[model samples]
Target: MPASAPEAPAPALPRPLIGWRLLALFYDLWPALALWMLASLCFTLGYTIAGHHDPHENIAPLSVLQWALWATCWLLAGLYAVISWRRGGQTLGMRPWRLRVVGADGRPPSWQALCARYAVGTLSLLAAGLGFWWAWIDRDRLAWHDRASGTRMVRNPKP
Candidate 1:
């Protein structure tokens, strides 16, 4: 019988370390901030159009409109994250860092999983980043959102 060539081994997954993840998060903040500002602007415009004609008047802090603005900003940021993750696994911030989100099975995660990730990540931040710190102690180096959503961040090899 003729000898055949050996099959190639599968490429290893490039798991990103916590430091890299943190850097990416920081980078991502710029875009998120922009989104928040945009949301705030729209809310302000609406308030103005609603006959709040005083030049110096603004949306009162702790008012329902202000709360709604906060919620809108949050949703906008979530949409930015989830849409980026779903479409390409990498957000603008993640691109420079070469970080990409992948499912546990090494594929694009479902919408539900992505949403869960965003929600948990928000909670993590609200908790003073304790969830992110969890990675340092986690056996697999996965954060709470990662474990909760069955998704992970992988560092892409340099070109």
Candidate 2:
């Protein structure tokens, strides 16, 4: 045989199993909950101060206002996820699990891509987590959000 160049090393797998990603999501909830609490406190204080009412009164908050609070919490959570992924390709939870999010080109995703992923991921969760569950059966083990955003959650070995 003619002299041939040595074969290049194969790259690491870019897809982690559903459990790790789910664990990451579960771990991420702590921060999101903290943000939501902080935000709700601010909203409550503002509303009470505006109405000149005691903030500690046992009262049912307005439904409309409750919805607004939910929206705010959702927005903050999305920002947290997108920012983390954009800056480092991993969040606090993903770090512990040695997981990373990368674009189809194997680089950090664009802001637009991250936003899309966050949005679709929310939808997936709202729909009983079918989107995340998709990974379990997918031939390539990619979630709906990953497929939609042209991004994938990759698994990395321990350092």
Candidate 3:
């Protein structure tokens, strides 16, 4: 008799809308806000220590520094998202909200994918958050970044 082949298990269905992803976004927003505030304070203190006669008069330098700090913060946030998403399949935000970022095949996203997502996300926000709003109207409920990176923010299964 010929050897019988084993059957593969059935694949799981994709997640439906649960609103957890939006909650995760809110959770993540707080930390970013705190970081921004701290960065601004540090810049202000450094400016004062430099003996600028009128700190307000150095608007150009301050603006440039502020932008740099903002970029750095955004990079840090991206790192956080990438690491958390790759390792645990969730960000600090996502964890609390029971959301996770995964590829179409249901695996954690790659670093390049994460970076691409963040870059698109930044651009989306720069365009007045229209990308985020896309989730509301998108058929799959995906944000701009999710669509761009071919990723999904799905409701994580409960452990």
Q: Best candidate per lDDT, number?
A: 1
Stretches of candidate 1 off by over 4 Å are: 1-8
* Clash tally for model 2: 0
TM-score of each: 0.92, 0.90, 0.77
Question: Who is ahead in TM-score, 2 or 3?
Answer: 2
In the range 45-149, model 1's lDDT, one tens digit per residue, is: 878878875536877779998889888989999999999999999998899889999999898999999999999999999999999999999988899999999
Superposition TM-score, candidate 1 onto the true structure: 0.92
Candidate RMSDs in order: 1.8, 3.0, 3.3
lDDT of each: 0.91, 0.90, 0.76
lDDT score for candidate 2 against the true structure: 0.90
Instruction: Compute the lDDT of residue 46 as modeled in candidate 1.
Output: 78
Please give, for residues 1-159, the per-residue lDDT of candidate 3 as tens digits: 999999997566455453655567779888777776786777777877887546665436557776887787887777777787788877777776577788877777888888888899889978988998888898777889998987887775567
Residue-by-residue lDDT tens digits, candidate 2, 82-132: 999999998888998999999988888999999999999999999999999
lDDT of 1 at 83: 99
